[model samples]
Target: MPSLLSSAIAHPARNQHLLLLQSSVAQTCLPVLRDVVQRSMERAREKTILFCLLYPPLSFLDKASRAQTDRLLVVDRTTYVPGYSDGLDFNDDVASFLRSAIMDSIQSSSLNIVIDSVDTLLSDINSVSATTRILSELLSIVRTRGGTSRLIIHVLAPCPLLPILTQTRFSPSLTHLIAHPTALLTHIASAYLTLPPPLSPPEKFWGVFIPISERHYESEKLVYGSAGEGSGLQDFVVEILVRGGADATGRRRGVERELEGWSPALGGPCEVRELDSLKSLCSEKPATEMQIVPDPTQNLPFNLNLTQEQAKSRAQVPLPYAHEGKPPVQASMPAAILYDPDSADDLDDDDPDEDLDI
Candidate 1:
């Protein structure tokens, strides 16, 4: 069976991933992420672009290193979002900057974007709101782009480095896993992958949990529905809870097998269309085949289109600023400038002070 990393990279849009790694951010997390991109590039028939924007100057890549294996193009962060030391280095409007970068990349090739080490961005005591808005907007990029090739978003290794999240025993992993650690994060985030919890099972299998629910927004927060066996967490644990047998539906659940000393660099590639996801990548939809913008009113319940009668009605709806009926209120042509010659006024054009100015 393929690893969670395989499933994640293969998945199309609507996957705003949160990867929580037990290993160090620079060491294990980064290599694993790079390998995912490399594998994707190798498997893909054409070009793929990776937008990896990070912070703290913890990078080994540069402008010259843009093209890796067959054709994996990495849009170096320094080139896109200005500022070097700060991760993403975006001002208050992180969304606008990120969207601008993503839009630019969409023109290049099939896009895969990464908000690497979000821990660095959320380090400040007051960046919570900005960070949330950034995440919320990033998840919505696919919908707003209105293209068949809207970029895939990946958020890797978020919690361990954040001070608030790392304080408690379970908070770091649970913070990344369960809800309300951050309201907008859980609401917009589609998938959560924790790479080997620090406290591991004795037998040692790489545990991967990804929960996807039909998104329901109430009070502007995401609420997840029952996926397979209750919540995604509960579903992932079903293997440990009830020793195996197919359910009444007889749908075979993914049987967890022990992995022997796994390293991403050594792992072979897995096929893409293995998971049960909304975005299907059964076969690659090449750029030539993809439509630029899909119909805006695709899945909306309310009608945005107007009937002929309705269009006429809308045309009749007088705009307040349109000045529909009021005649042009011309200001009486500046009331005929009457300087009716002040009795003592001199009309001389020549400078009166010329004689005194010598």
Candidate 2:
């Protein structure tokens, strides 16, 4: 998949922005989480604060630099539960703890709040309304402060809330997926980005960055233009390739690269009719054919050369700026006279003397 950091950077957040990164599998999101943390660390000197609600736990952050970790304030996901042995509760309010963390981060620097997975949090809380309220409050806080806060969230794809009809058969339409957890997150987010599922098993590591809203896609399309003719929304697909390697600590690391020429259309199942309609609308209009008209004077063998006198007269003619009646205003003295010390005495002599006090 494409590097989440690079994609996020490309779609820069304005002041008080919320960003969502939705995918089906939680593991697929790890690379992006690491990348964002590292980027936050690099910019920490600029007073960037990162608050991470790590559902997968602190071990996921081990690959991040010490500086990155120092800049981060994390809330263990277990704390959200009331009776869990490892849970940390203050006044029995997980909402309060989250608010406090956000406020503290804002006080120090611009906040970058990342929640590993809202779906997991919702499940833990077992109250969608309560979780939604908390999220709404946090978003409001960021907006009211007028400080640019990038709230990055990961949501599971094929969301659990999506109704399953039978064990073998599934809802094949996008309408069924609209009520997914990520969809709810989308309603509040400033930008909704999706990491589309891979095409083939071999290409499973590759994904495309797609904007959640058509309006946003249109605005971007106007600015960047279509990628190619007949390409449809696939023209805007930014391919992200996930690679595995070792960090300085010899721990297995995952990194992302932005590849070229890959289209989202090639990956995952989509509503064909909707895509077809959009393709028809966005397709480039063909150029109109027109006959070239010959210049009226092209074949005329008229005198093309000007006489010396005529040329001289043309050259001598005053330009539009040079009025015929008024002399041009001289704002400064001649270079020679201005620079010459001898001319200074002459200029002084020309000045009328005033009566001196006796």
Candidate 3:
């Protein structure tokens, strides 16, 4: 049987690379991130590990059993005051500390670095270009190491920058710096994974994973993808992870009771006693009489200028067709009379000689 890590990754024992995971809701994806980190730790037993958490505190890391490993180095930069912490200040060289830490980690033995939320880093820097530059440098360092070192970046899905990038047509320079930050990371990363919002119960969520440069066979495709003949390309694969009930220790006694009588051998065959009773009750009731109401508009006075007899005669007569044998007769044109301007002036003089005095 394949392990969880083997199933998720194309090759578990690969070189240094980047993996990005994104989701709309943070809570829904935290578990998935934890799962990946746990799996990574299992694979890289002697490797140096670094966790840079931006959203949750050190206590949240305990949930993922990070406390068990002494090799795990955690940088709790989740809390920062605008004026108090000079090194953690967001406005001035915000990512300088983070960059330094990542650089130090890459220099050590085969390293595994996990940045909890890249969205928080971008928010603090407040400059897309600067934040992107910082991330690019960090990724470059990891790739340069080219060993078991890997970088996992978690970001929120449907990133706020996506809409601005898509709606507004910006210049090439601005577009490169500002638009769809997650999309930019996706292109940079060796593999990308996205977590959709959780269902109503919040126990399960869907994840899509795509390996950038790796070629996968049709048999290696996900359950749904395995059905059709694949193009032998690195296709995006989807997996659903179901988290057991919050209280795993407590057995559901009520559910067990409900299932007790569900066995056919013990309860006998199923019968529809209610169906016959319902039919008997319905037969006792008399059929209802439906009354048709006359239209109110029927008595309305619509005064068209035709009598009942004239309307009947008009309705009986068929309309004449232009295509019938009876051709339409054209009216004769009257002869045009020619009038000279000089003759008209003489006629006007005769008519108005008495009326107008020269």
Candidate 4:
């Protein structure tokens, strides 16, 4: 079976997605996720979002990051409630209020909603049913808007009330598989993404493996395009410039060599029907075509790029105010390294961040 990475790169303008994000925020995959959201917006030509529940350095916290922030809408439900605190009660009114706000925000254009940890709410008595109800209402609202809106919701608890679930529950024996984890995820998420737990010891540079729901195959089709006759060949080749590595010419150079050779017609306006036919041909006989090598001279070390220097200098760090002359204010450290496993076991099996007030 093809991987989620294949599916995601194939279809960027999907209407809905249910991603399993890790509780930590320091993971390097944030850049990849942001890239996906940006590309989705580019394809749809509308506003996009990254809704967060518990995490710091949220993309939309200040003016400096506001442009990126404007594209995101965050919901910090952690403060209102704490982790694993089963003492509180679910306020239907508050849940309804938040749901309305989210619906309004998504009404204007294509948006992506994310609920970081559903397990947080699982602690409250009857929390699963209540949250499921609210989320169902929110899904209805998004569907009514008629744009390509998606969601990357997270689940921390073992069992959920939704059908579109990302993580799977444990099984002691064949009998344990008799009961379903929950339908709440499926009811809200059109595609489910899961990740497996850490089985081996942590490596220096940890990477996550995600398996998106197989439903992707049934949900959409991939179209291929061809260069119009007599058009320049430059339009057929996509130039990729990575932040590192030696630059070379022709195909086997730079980062482009890392990607499997699959070039779609992306230069200009092409007939969709023709693109569809080309895709069918490729699928039937992928080896019949000759491999066109990508041009090199793209990769360069980040420290060598002046633009990168400026970015590194401006990165957020604790510094004294020019006038105060006192000590600098304490700044919180970056988020933890986390992974969102695309698997049934990654869902809400326990409520870890649901006790504090929102």
Candidate 5:
């Protein structure tokens, strides 16, 4: 069976779009994009248009796709892209520009969009609702196209726009369900992957000492093109909304989390692996599901697991629900409930009290 990572990948119409919550590393999407684009080519025999905010990487795209990669009008260093109206900015009409680009670039067979730097886009756009709305419109457009069109939205999570979501104790689902920017994206995308930032020195201490802080960050110290704490990608927390399972509100109605390991190859894409523990489950007898929330009574000063003698003794003791002081109930002589009638239902209240002694 395919790993969770593979299953969560953006498929044709089956899984149209993906919202990737990336680490600080910008190039975390490169490996997956290579694989997805390759799959698109093999399956559809067509080119995928990449609408990248940064310059597109050369490894996957053709000369044409590369030329059109950074198609969004941008001024070199400011909010306004020069060559457009003097004071107008990309942010002023980002959604319209994307709609025009997508409509123009679409062809007979298929079209795929890879937004490489949604972090920067969100930073510049500065409105979570607007960003989400634009993506939804694009999703609707692709769905109506009646072909293998898909959108793979790859974005880093840390920016001024997101308010340092990584530093918080909040779960991704909580953030997505709240007013946070992640909500609509997670709701709309068929698959959502979180490349969580690695634990810093303090966070990794395993309760040795109270951490003064959990994560530390510095811009200049970041090492690009590597998967270490501050550099590149890591394992993914994959959440897939089954296709066609959304409700009338345009939100998937369930929640689950699956994790798998990934090792990015040098100068290439990546490989995913199921954990070592799951492989041994085949031979083992099927058991009750692994508990998600652990038993609250565990890991206390007293031992919880019983020895054989303790268990046997405990079993012998009578209890209200399971056992009584007498012999066990049997099929032939089952326990019964009886109500005695008092003297054929006599009803002489004053005289009966006086005659009770006699």
Candidate 6:
């Protein structure tokens, strides 16, 4: 049986490289990224590490709720460490420890890391030079592990680093950890999901996140060169809601909050035109005659207007007389008119001739 990650990965032979990012790191590009986590959760591999970069603490909650991995370990600079008794430790040393702990956790459980906000982490790194060094070391440690653990770093920075991530490689403990970008990366990810557009028109696009291959191990790459087919793509819809720092246990309450705000599914029934139309179904009134208002918008079978003679003749016609009334009463309309002329020819001509003579 194929692993969950293998199944989630479509066409591993053609394209290789997975670049998974939070649909939104900031408020601007949410619609595109909101469903990213949900879809990612459905299509996640057991040994995959989802690195998330979020700005607000609440945002972290949302991301965590949507995509659950084997182990969820949060690393935040803003929060205090519980065990540190000395008036809450807040130093780079603690951050380093947390990073190492994360790597250790990964080793125990296939080494999957969810960095909530890489952009934020980069920003918080006291020294870009030293911080990068620390990250390099951690990534190196992760790569050296015997287990084939995949690392997904979600970087929120959009301007330069975002585009250059593929070409860029920092020295890792193991040289192969240098990440590269590919078509599979772009195909698996939807750029539209991260676009900061108006909320009214909810049009979204799908993009695939392919894994960056190691320079030496070509065959070890999950996806190859062809760019996998589109049959494996999944569609998702996402909405964001303001969670007021609630102690909610599950992801649903957060979703409910979002639904309450957006109300995406509020258009009501298509055929129901007026409140009165809905009243019939809701109230269940036993009406003797339900007046059907002619929908001018709809195509109707019967003509609305009729001449006086036509109205009188139609009024004289009995309802389904062919089925209800006596069987041989008489042939209807055209049949009566079409009857043999010889049957009525006995008396009419003689009376007409007498009138002409007078």
Every candidate's lDDT: 0.37, 0.42, 0.40, 0.35, 0.42, 0.34
Lowest lDDT sum, 10 consecutive residues, model 3, at 254-263
Model 1 clashing-pair count: 1
Worst-scoring 10-residue span by lDDT in model 6: 255-264
lDDT of 3 at 238: 23
Candidate 5: residue pairs that collide? 74-81, 75-81
lDDT of 3: 0.40
Q: Write the per-residue lDDT of candidate 5 for residues 1-358, one digit (tens) a residue.
A: 5543454443433323433434333224455555565566555334454554554455555666445433322222233334553743544444555566556555545555555556666655677667666665655655555455565565554444344332222112211100011111222122222211122132232232112111223221222214323333433222232323233344663443332334443222122123221223212333565446578878799987899999999999977653336576588996787445588797556675685776
Q: Candidate 2's residue-wise lDDT over 164-252, tens digit each?
A: 21111221111101111122122322233322232222233232123332223343343344541222223222233223323234565
Name the better of 1 and 4 by lDDT.
Answer: 1
If scored against the real structure, what TM-score would every candidate get?
0.35, 0.39, 0.39, 0.34, 0.43, 0.32
lDDT of 6 by residue, 42-97 (tens): 43332333333354334534665634434444444444334543343324443554
Query: What are the RMSD figures for all models against the true structure?
Result: 26.7, 20.9, 21.6, 32.7, 14.4, 19.9
Which model is ahead, 2 or 6, in terms of TM-score? 2
- Per-residue lDDT tens digits of candidate 4, residues 1-358? 4322333432422333333332121111233344344455444334444444443334424444435543444444455555454533435433554455455565355545544445555544346556766555555554555445554444432345433342222101000001011121122122323211121222210121112112222111211123212222111111111211122222221221111111234422222123332333223324535465564535755444357667788776557644456454456755554455676765767777688677
lDDT of each residue in 1-358, candidate 3, tens digit only: 4322233332233332555544442112444455556665565342434445455544335655666444465566676544466554432332454455445554454555667676776666677777566655666555556655556666654454433322213211110110011221223222332222221111221113223212123122422243433221111222222121111234321110000001122221111111221223213233342355666657557844688899899999977754467444446755554444664455543655577776
